[model samples]
Target: MIDLAHTPVTSVPGVGPKRAEELKKLEIESVADLLGYFPYRYDDFRVVDVAEAVHDTKVTLKGSIYGTPSIRWYGRKKSRLTARIDVNGVYVKVVWFNQAFLKKKMKTGETVVVSGKWDAHRLQLTADRTWFGQESEKHVGRLEPVYSVTSSLSVSWLRKTIYGAFAAFGREIEEVLPQKLRSRYRLLDRARAMYYLHFPKGREEGVQARRRMVYEELFLYELKLLWHRKQEKAADKGMTRRLDHEKLDRFIESLPFPLTGAQRRVVEEIVRDMADESRMNRLLQGDVGSGKTVVAAIALYANWLSGFQGAMMVPTEILAEQHLRSLKELLAPTGMNMILLTGGMKAKEKREALSQIQMGLADVVVGTHALIQEDVIYRSLGLVITDEQHRFGVRQRSKLREKGETPDVLHMTATPIPRTLAITAYGDMDVSVIDEMPAGRQPVETYWVKSDVWSRVVEFIGKVCRTGRQAYVICPLIEESEKSDLQNAQAVFEEIAEELAPIRVGLLHGRMSPAEKDEVMRSYAAKEIQILVSTTVVEVGVNVPNATVMVIYDADRFGLAQLHQLRGRVGRGGGQATCVLVADPRSETGIERMRVMCETTDGFEISQKDLELRGPGEFFGVKQSGLPEFKVADLLEDFKVLELARADAAEILEATDWEEAPEYRPLREYLDRFQKEQAKFD
Candidate 1:
């Protein structure tokens, strides 16, 4: 048996260098890659009797050519080939468009099979695919796989190439799962499953093959995650800290507001993890304004009491500053010395901060990626916290953790993810969610309006402004593009400023410098700018309680999660707030997104809907979130299979001698190969 993973696609009989280049466009560089490239759909070509065919439904028919086929050219490169077929003594008109060569192939008394839509009203059959006598025997009785191909590669050619590859290397394809596991899951053999996946004799067989592939993909991923978790625990010794419950209770009491029940539960979980001897890697997730900051502050304070320095990293400088201010206020009673470090800080300020950090003077340090730079040092770093954890890559988080001596890490995200995604994306870490919001916070009132009602929305914003409350007018684009029809922030700012006189509208976008953005945000927060027209830069960590209304233009252009996040910017104060979504959505998906925004404010529910609509790849971002892309598994549709695979993977890992046992040799070998392949990219 050859090593398929190392063999190039050109090894296949018909695939030359040029053909291999075409395959490379589909990410099929290796024989294994080509085999893993599953078809998006299957075309059922099973023969059906012409008399039994229904109107407008696709059916395959076997018949004899009753007369000579004729071709009529109507225009350049366009022609219609018409013929009559006799099926059981019944004559039916068959039409083929742009297939002039078929006229020469079909003759009187010739047998043929055609798959197409049956038009009962017109008493005709429109053929999409045709097979001459011998070819019909191979295709007319089974489901045909349809591969997604570029224009240079036809579906027929790709299908044939895959079939040839399977015929040549079918036996060489190793079964990664052990025999006992296969029997327990009722899965087909790997080689058989691959063959049936590409060419199934029946629909049931195709479904079974797909199920096997999905389970295998998910099971391998779960195994890798669980194994990493086990390795992390075995490799690193964590700091065990005293809880100091009395000190922590006093610090919590010093806060301006009380913690929600969910926050208290998550706090207890984090404290317990900190008290344990093992390293803590926990994810703290909650909806916007859910007091995650307070909980994080408590954790940092607890770490301070444990007599170690704690560091907090955020995605942006603005968010870093905001956290510094809020945490300072929350933990002021503890007399914990905190320092700020960021890329935008001046040379003198940064030097002083770095010196303080190295001298152990900075008890709680907060900053952006600057904290992870080589120059900064922590004297006794014990706990690491990253806010908006999805925004940073895995390596960045790891770098921050590496700065300490096996420090306990807490990842906090305002974006609430569904349980299925949590299980897959953050499988290596324990998860804690703050599902409750603080008291006195009201649900933002939401409404969907068309472009024709723009006047009314502007008037409503003016009314809100007159009452001394602020509003946000969000656009999808920063500046006008000749190619885009969506509203831009600059243009909308001008229009709204004119429509609502003396409302003090200010424009903020990504194009602005950090200092300029800070100034604009400061104005908005101080009530100097009543309406801030901006792009999606305000989607995260922008808290302005006085902003009572949010009007988003071209809301259809944004995803449900984004829209929910944008709406969260408002309704933070004691006053009732409203969100008006202005969109003239043309597609059903866009319309449905708008409707979902108007229906619910639950971040988790909206995220689930977003996953179903846009899938996991776009939920946050596959690459950014360190999510693995699977060939046959769908995180949304195949969630139950994922759960089963996760459970099985955990069970296998629990065995004391599974790694060295002969029964798990196949699985162990596959994992070794998988890790080596993964290391190449890393």
Candidate 2:
């Protein structure tokens, strides 16, 4: 009976091997996969009158066909089925393109229900779905789940197969949550939740079912994270360092700028962590120009003073070089030896860097992934730092630690995350946020304007360039293609150059070779490129304090955190900076996003709004983030449920040994199975 989870999808009624192949495109190969496959949205198929249909909106209406749908041929092979429907003296033409077979199902003066978009241009309804004779009770006047599909699969068929599967096997579906916990939370039974999630009677029941399912997903994820943290704590035997406050102060005072209060507080936190016997696994999160690098340097300096080596890994060669140059200037004055190692370096140069690191002659080494190579050994490595923490996964981070004897790890990200997101994404490590910007750093004045005003923005860029300031023009795509309608960097660069002749514009994109990209970046850094047009590749540590303007075309395509990062590229030089968002959003949500971007430069506040607007999957980028792929949970909408689930898991852990307890057998089994499934992806 337990093998039902892996039963082939073809075993379901009406789903043969051919249909199973189509389902496989959706990652639904087994019964369990089919069950877990969820709808992206729902369509309200409640009955209404044809006269009440809103233009350009999807609606369902019941009416009598005035005559048989006539099949007409056009453009050689194209066919259209056209018919007329009358309801209470209102007549509307209904059309279905390339669906000539639909004409066979309809006859003159027949009662039928159709759901589709009502187009006002032709005074017609484009019928994408129809129910013959009488509306089915299963769908009419109810909330209908709309599954995402491939070209070969239909939502109608998929919905029917799911309903049939539930009728056959719903009772056999295991309840992963313990009965006691479910009762305490007032959650519906597992079988009931499953039924309502896919075939709800109304919006209220649908929301309730979604809440319960989301709680289960978050609860499982939280348990796994908490368990991992517990294990790490049990195994920790970290460095216990004694710091020289006088030496640290001398290094801080020698810096070109004074440290902000927030920076000082974070440095103190690091010092406390390093002095403890347990390993320091902390995440340092801050906004752009919040001075996180300085805090990292202070920690590395403290490690150096304790007679140990330190290493910092970045994601790109340019960022590694930038860090090397900055750290050399800052730490060398205090007699610290810092060396740069990158994959692009000559073989002989890399050999020398590795030799110094192995010989303990180099106090600090900064590089890209080259620092983690097998040949580059550290003699007494006591500290490891990874910048842009999201770029590296858990196992890759562990590989860096393998170089040292479980050295204290400090991960850094400039991405300002919301509170609930921080709790879940970085549950395994302690988090410290530098919420305050350094004194004297100017907030970039942001504006959201229509794309039609490109000429005005270009004129403003020209003015800023004449003042000896640089600018960036970011596009969502690298190049235009037939597949996408978005504006691209290459075309925008040409347009900008034509509009503002002799402005010395440069084009940069991810498709360029490393050498090409580096050359373009060098030009921009030297103030040679007055207007640099590029993609989000420039969103990271491309620091040019001279750049004062950022013009993001189609800015609505970006999330709030991304917009903030792009905005951070400017306002680094302490003078006035501006971020112009050129966008013409179609949806209300898209317009609201632009409003949020223009309202404030407070990253945390922006992040909260972003989380609220776009659910966690989209806000955090489901593909890139370490967050789990949930079937029903939404980090933004179900935050309260997440808190409760976390508390329940903690209570369960403390109450008994869940592995051996009979009441927790189902939970343990589910977790074990989940781990096994995750291992396949790992």
Candidate 3:
């Protein structure tokens, strides 16, 4: 049997400690790890003749190398060798590299089969592989598998180890899949799959085995997610607060302008959801400048009328500050008390804010992730508004709800998601979309120009600043790197500041300290800085009405949604805003991507296309706000599977929640194991 404890790799016949260390680099620590290392390729050698072999040619020829080889040292780094191999009706030269000792093996004419590359120009043979075996030509059977190898590990040792492991207890590792489930899922038994996958008779069988295993892995992962959803629903707290429309109506009317059609529709939905008893966990998605903040403000006001406090959580301190200011301005006429709690707040100011919150003095609390911190409790928090929902996790959302007795949640996203995605990703929650941009919100004009047009681009920003307006210049990096050609925020900032010496300009990047970032952003927002050069840190929540020009350096490096977001930083004022995209002619695909931003300003269209092209991953998401990130099932392609799984989970819960039903025992065990694995491994 393959001894899990004592069977060292070298004991399998060839590998020693030095070789074992090499295998360990490939994550092959034990006999099992080595056995499971699969191949990425296979080579078939079925046809070959000895005499037909020529120099500089790779052929599988049945031949014999009888003459001793001569090795010649070329340079400090190079070596050469030559030998005589007798082939089908002819003789050929066999060449080896740095193996001068092979010269001891010649007696005029001994027979040995060889396989190597043919050098046609020099009429020589370069060894790729060679063997002296029983067969001359007839059916040596199938192709040899070629596995992925690192510099430290060789394919020969890996293959030998797997075969050695299999020789012992190969049958013991076979899957224990239930017959009914296997037949239903059309899956292979684990043992049979391992055999075929590692040593298939042909290509077709190997492919079939791979498909079966991948599908099984995905299916089980999907099934577990559905089970978790069931547990959540069964434990639903169901705390709904009645929102008075007139209380919110007064607050809405207090704003400078009317709500857009999209905003009104979302407001009605939130109010309706809050009006009922089911806890409100809804998503509010819309494009830039779609008026989601006003909708959130009105919702908070409704909570005030319900005799409870409200909380607004955002992704960053800058965004939290922006919301704090916007809510204060929007609700000032209605006399709502809005307070801010961020990481950078003064100790005494934060203490006062906390005291005010606990005593029900602050009507609405707005901040970054700090809003959900312990010791900052509310007397009776009825509503929780999370902006940029993808930035936070599901557990974080639950924690926020824990801050209250299951407070109603309203998630906000400036980047819109597709319908199928909404249904699959946020399957358990209701959705509201602010599809229409507010009236008089002029679309920002865009330009895609080559780097050769740099002079003209600088002039455009200057002209906008000369008109007493501000502008934003964006770069993708913090500093130039030897690995990349993109411009950094600091270099661009310095360059632009010198280029436009008379204008007040500033710099901001992710590496800046939190206090420094806030200070710079504060200056830019207050128009103390007429031009701000930044990285994608400017990708969200900056409201500069006077800034009408946005210049993105290396525009093609950003995704479509990201491009749309950076472009959104402009065009918030009465004058026409311009967003210029600078790129090189060589980046055709990148220009095509940025065109989405130029062609349409809708976050929904761009997000939909992006989701279609690149499915759900860590790169784009709602965890930033307080939503869960999916691991296996895609929000776009496998949306239907999600719906089916969700519904099935619901039915299972209704029949027997918390393992109250005997039929759910298997699934429950699977979930328990899965959770334990994620916790331990991840």
Candidate 4:
């Protein structure tokens, strides 16, 4: 038995440096990595008669070649090797695309086994894989593991490499779970499970092996989460405040508009959490235009009433300024002074703001990442709120929280994550959702228009502007990238300005300076600009009640949740609003995505559809949604396993601390190793 982790993949026979580099692309660096690289799917080697094979389905057939395989080239780049196999008395055509070398290897009258998709449309079998030899029951009557491959690595190479590593280190596969727990779960021993998972004799064996592996993966993940949760609990004491209901009532009454029921409920949750002995680590999720800012303001006001300082951090300087202004307007009656401390501020201005913040002259502070700089000190920071929470990574949020002694943290995001994913991603924190829209808010009328209908869309925009309302034209790119065919913000701005002559059109994107962006947003809000051409940088914080039209170019490129958020830019003032999506996608999925945009305005519904379409990895990946990557446990397909792992982890933690138990030493060490590896990625 060898140390699998210390043994590199290159040590495997036939895996030179070149092959090792290719394996590295799949994150397989060691013998242990190779063993853990589970197969994505399995293939059945049970041979069936050619006549019994169903069309459009994968099947294996064993027969002898009736004639020599011939290479046919449809074009200079298009070619296929075709052969006819004799099965009993029926003849089935087998085809392999672009592999002309198969013609030389497969001889007439030679026995072969082929597996492929039986294409009924062409009445031919398009071979995905093939083997040449006498059909033996050992290889033809069992299940085979099929691994995901790269262009440089073939399935056969991966299989051979894994087997070679197993031969060398199979005995070193240590068991992390205790024997008693394994018996309770009816799980196979670690070494036997690996063998059965890689090379199983039957479907049941493969299924059981996979189940065992899935449980192990999810159990380890849940256990780590439990550990992290405990660490958060044991952190230094946090702000424990008393609520001033009279002050809250006066603030609520002073507001021009009433808070929605959902908003009120979420605010109550925040207030309750803030008063608890433990710190309030809560995530506030809401759709666009749901008045999340008001709820956040109320929370900050409560902290202020307790004679504690509060901070709100946004992703962009434009957003930070916006929050500063809006909070000033909302909290004017409370007589609390709030100051802005952004990186864009001049030295003199920044010095003054820092002095005020440090001396407790500023009750509330709003800024970008500059608020977390080492030089910035708080007099008595009690509450920390991060707007557009997905845009900030775990490190940034942690840095801000470190400013105070376990400050009550509140994270807010307009990006509507699905309920299940929210639970999984933010499992360590409490969650509150603002599901209801504000009163008198109207649903934006949405439409899907083809690119060819650009003239009509322009005409509509002009009409809306002529009616004294503003419009937004959102392009997917700041500047045209060679890889994408979408319109850029500058190009679209020029085109719209020229087409709609005399109409003041402003441009905004991420590339612009923060001051420049603020200028454009201010102009747009003041109605000095009738139409605004921009990128998704305007997706979060800018608000204008008069903007009633939203035209998104290449809208299909955006997820449904984002498209919904863009639509939310309009219809803010209870007037009729319209959202036009310009796209002409070809795939059924793409077409369905556009259709979903036109069908609903509910952010949660759109997010659910987005999750179903993109899965958890892609959904979280689209934005900087901070979630730990699980190696084998899928939040969707293995959701039940996740639930089981969570429950089991709670029970185990209640019984004993694994680190202190002699029998659980192996599990604790394994968990430590896993946490260290996961931290490298974070």
Candidate 5:
């Protein structure tokens, strides 16, 4: 087998230094990368009789040039070449734009083939590609791969280069999937799949090739994830905690409201994981206002009952303070020592907090990334919980985990991921979802309105505040930008403050300092500010029960998940809350987003819709979410294949000697190379 990874694209025929640079723009530097660069779409150039061809449809015609092609120049570098073709007694007019050079190639009464869209109204065919008599037999009547190309590259050149590479190395292409597995799945071999992927005989062959490639991509990714999980489980010895059922029952009973069934189930799952001999790496996913914080507090209480320190890391200091306050209130009956540690804390305060954490006096510590700092020492840290886990990178989470001796890590996120994303993105960790809302929690009434009804929206906000409740006015931007026409927080704050005089309205944005943002949020939570005009910074953990009205301006500017999160800030209290989406969307996608938000409050459904509309790259932000960018597999469309790959990977790893078995040697080698590539980025 050829070493495709080490083989340069420059080794291919017609690929000089300049051509190699152009190929690099498409991220194809090596022969392997070039082979993986699948076409986005294909153009069918099957020959068709002129009489049988439908007008206004793309068709290829094989015929003899009836006359000499003539060229007419209209402007600089602009010319039109017109010709007549006779296909078995039927004559058709053909035109080529800016191809004056074709005049030399188009000979009178010469056999040629053309592919283009035939216009019935104009009685002409606008030819896109032309080939001579014998060449047409090999080039036409097949699916031609149309690649995404840069300015310096042409589709024909890329196709020819890929063909050349295949001719040289096709027989040497190594298979990564085991023969038994491929037979079971009825998948095409790697070399055949690559050929059919770029140049297929029929649509079914193309589909089969694509399915095989997608499955292989997802299967390898799943293998890597499961392998890492296995390594971690074997490397570390987990702490098996002894649960105090009596104290846990008392704590549950002491809550103001009864636990939801879903909450209870997830808590039980977590407690079971803590008591197990295997270290727990789990994801706790819940929608906004899903009472996840209370569940997390209970988990921390359980850790305390086991006589171990627990650290909760949040994204922002404001969220950290909020968690500290809420955990303190929830754990008040047990007298657990909960302390706050943030980067903004004073020198003396930081020192005291650090000393308490190191001395084991702090039972439940809530803070931002400050908890993972080098100087901060933990005394018997047993559990580590990260809120809004997407905000932190893999290394940051690892740093926090390294703080303790194989601490049980629980990742929490308010962003309810779709099942497809949850399985793939968090494939390394076990996932627990709190899908139920607490009893008596009201759903926020949502409405969509255009900007022409801004007056009515403002009046509604005023009426909501007049009833002794708070409101939130969300804008997409903090300040006016020359590029965007969307409403900004400062302008909206000024407008609302003047519209509703005597009602305190506050402005909060990311541009504000931490202290300033925290002060604004504190005042809003205290009900001193009847209306808070802010950006999506309040989309995560800001909880004000009195804020029953949410008015979002330019709602189309935000994604469906973000809009849902913003609406969740309201409807947390007993009273009926309302969310008004003010938007004048231009595109159908924007309009659909608004419609979806107004239609339902289910974050998972909204997330699935978001995944469908924005795709996984934007939904989970592959760069930050640590999701691998697949070349052929789509997280939404190819979810079934992903499920199969994940299951198959698990079964394969269950075999103790699979790693050493000759049958699995190719997969092992591929995984070894993949890890080395990943290590470079790390």
Candidate 6:
């Protein structure tokens, strides 16, 4: 197998020294790197000769050039050249644009063919030559690899270098899948899967090969995850605290509405783990609006009630602020300090908060990554909870644990994972799910609508904002772009502020300084801003219960779980909230995806559906979570394999008493290298 980390791109036979540097510009560095650089698409140009062209028929014609190209320059930087060829008494016109070299290269009366929709031209047949090349055109195939390239490197060269690597080192890469599973899945041998996918002669073959590879990726990812889980769970031998139902019951009853059965189940599971002497490392899986926050709050509050300081870490200042509002309300009667800490606060203010925290005046401290700062000391940190746990890498979570003298960890994610995948990726932690919405939390009326429906929605938002209800308008991009249809955060901000001039408009996105973002969020939380235009940066953070409307532009661009999270941000105040999915329905694919979001709001069910629709590796967002990247597995698609791997890993770990087993030597070595790689990612 090619070790891409140490091997240079020039080592690939065909890539030579000159092309190797150019390839580096594209971030392609080695054999393993090139192998994963799959084609964006396949362009097929296999067809018959042009002599059989009908009057207005569309067809692909491939043949040798039969005539000399004449250069025709009209205006500034304008050019055109045409070639005439006779084939079976039919004269065909071939036109070229700006190919000055072709004028001197081609000889008249050589047999050449061109392809496009045949058109009638003043007593001659004519067609635009969209498909043409030299000798290569003569051997058209069922599938042609179209590569993404810079001007310095040609597609043919890339294809050749990539092809050579696969041919030479393909078999060297180990097959991670067991034989029995491979046969059951009907997957091709690992080498064949790579070869066929890269250079298949036919479309069907390419599809089959790609499917096998994709399946392998999903399966292996799951296995690695489950393996990680087993090791973590097995290593957990520390004492855990229990604050049972009495504490949880009080919080639940204090709420205006009753806790959903799903919420109760998760809370009970949390208490169960806390009661055990072993440290509780658990993941709370819930969808947007699944009431995960309340359940998490209960765990933190329980730890505090039992005389331990609890810490809640969120990904963004906006989310941290949001959690603070909800937790403050929930822990109000409990008289917990419920202190807040974020990177955005004034330096002096932060210092004071730190002083209070060190003084142990803050029982439950909530903040973003600031909680993990080396200078921020904790007093008896017993529990650490991270919302949207995927955003933080494994070591980052462990770092927070270090702050609390090895605090019992609780990781929370609103992203729903399929059962098999969960066992693989989060296997180390026991799973608790908040599957139900609290009773009387009106389901946000959701819709996947085109731009035409927005005028009324905007008016409605204006009305809602006027009535003391806040609205969130989420744009897909942070700023304007020439290449995408999703409105930028800035554009949406300007548009909304213009549309509702009377209402105070606020903007929040990833690009803002943490302090700037915090101020905007705090203003929104205070209801100083009536309408907030934001990017998905606000997806996990920024809780404004009085905000009753969520309008996500380019809604189709987001995955189901994410859209659910954004939707969950609203509907927090118990009053009815509306989730409007504004998207372009011009494309059937875009419309179909949006329809799924509108059809059902169940996060777990949607997560499974998303895996089926978009594959497991993409089950989360496209942004790679800072984990060791796996080349052959996906957590979503290969859940079963994950379960098996996790079980096997646990067995091996237990057998060795956590470090004694010979079987774990290879895995331990891999993990050590992987940990270094993860540091680079950080």
Please tell me which predicted candidate would have the highest TM-score against the true structure: 5
lDDT (Cα atoms) of all candidates against the true structure: 0.90, 0.86, 0.74, 0.86, 0.90, 0.73
What value of lDDT does candidate 3 attain over all alpha carbons? 0.74
Candidate 2 — which residues are off by over 4 angstroms?
1-3, 6-168, 201-204, 228-281, 315-318, 328-335, 343-352, 390-399, 418-430, 447-538, 549-563, 580-597, 604-627, 654-656, 678-682
Model 4 score (lDDT): 0.86
lDDT of 5 by residue, 1-682 (tens): 6799889999888889999999989999999888888999999888888777898899888889996778889988999999998989977899999988888887788899999999877668999989986878887779989999998899999999999989987887898898877999999999999989999988899999999999999999999899878877888779878989888988999899899999999999998889888899999999988889999998999999998999999998878988888898888889899999999999999999999999999998899999999999998999999999888888999899999987899999999999998887788889999999888888899999999989989998998899899999999898989998999998999999999999999999988898899999989988889999999889988879888999999999889999999999998878799999999999999999999998999999999999899987888675666677888888878999899999998888898888688989988887788779878997
Tens digits of lDDT, candidate 1, 570-600: 9887778899999999999999999899899
Question: TM per model?
Answer: 0.90, 0.74, 0.70, 0.84, 0.91, 0.63
lDDT of 3 at 143: 58
What is the alpha-carbon RMSD of candidate 3 to the true structure?
7.0
RMSD of each: 3.2, 6.2, 7.0, 4.5, 2.9, 7.8
In candidate 4, stretches whose alpha carbon ends up further than 4 angstroms from where it belongs are 1-31, 63-135, 148-189, 240-261, 343-352, 373-375, 393-396, 423-428, 477-485, 498-502, 615-618, 622-631, 656-665, 674-682
> 1-682 in candidate 2: lDDT tens per residue?
5566778888778889899889988989988778777788899898777556788999887777896568889987799889998765677888888888778778878877888998867768898888887545556898889999999888898999998888777777887788888888789877788889998888888887887788888888888777667666778789767878888888898889898888988888988888788899999999888989889999999999888999999988889989888887777776888999888999899889999999999999998888888898999999999999888877778888889986889999998888788888878888888999888887899999898888899899989988888999999998888998788999999998998878899999989998899899999998888999999999988889899999999998888889888999998888899999999998888898899888899888988888888877787777766676677876776778888888888888777577698878877776678678768997
Model 6, residue 572: distance off in Å is 4.6
lDDT of 4 by residue, 29-54 (tens): 99889888878777887888866788
Q: How many residue pairs clash in each candidate?
A: 0, 0, 29, 0, 0, 16
Q: Would you list the clashing residue pairs of candidate 2? A: none
Candidate 6 off by > 4 Å = 1-16, 19-40, 43-142, 149-152, 158-176, 226-257, 272-289, 301-307, 313-363, 366-377, 387-399, 413-433, 445-682
Candidate 3's displacement at residue 72, Å, is 9.1
Q: What is the Cα-based lDDT of residue 645 in candidate 2? A: 82
Model 6, 212: alpha-carbon shift in Å? 2.9
lDDT for position 345 in model 1: 92
Q: Which stretches of candidate 5 lie over 4 Å from their true place?
A: 7-31, 49-57, 64-79, 83-91, 100-110, 120-123, 148-158, 245-250, 343-352, 393-395, 481-483, 678-682
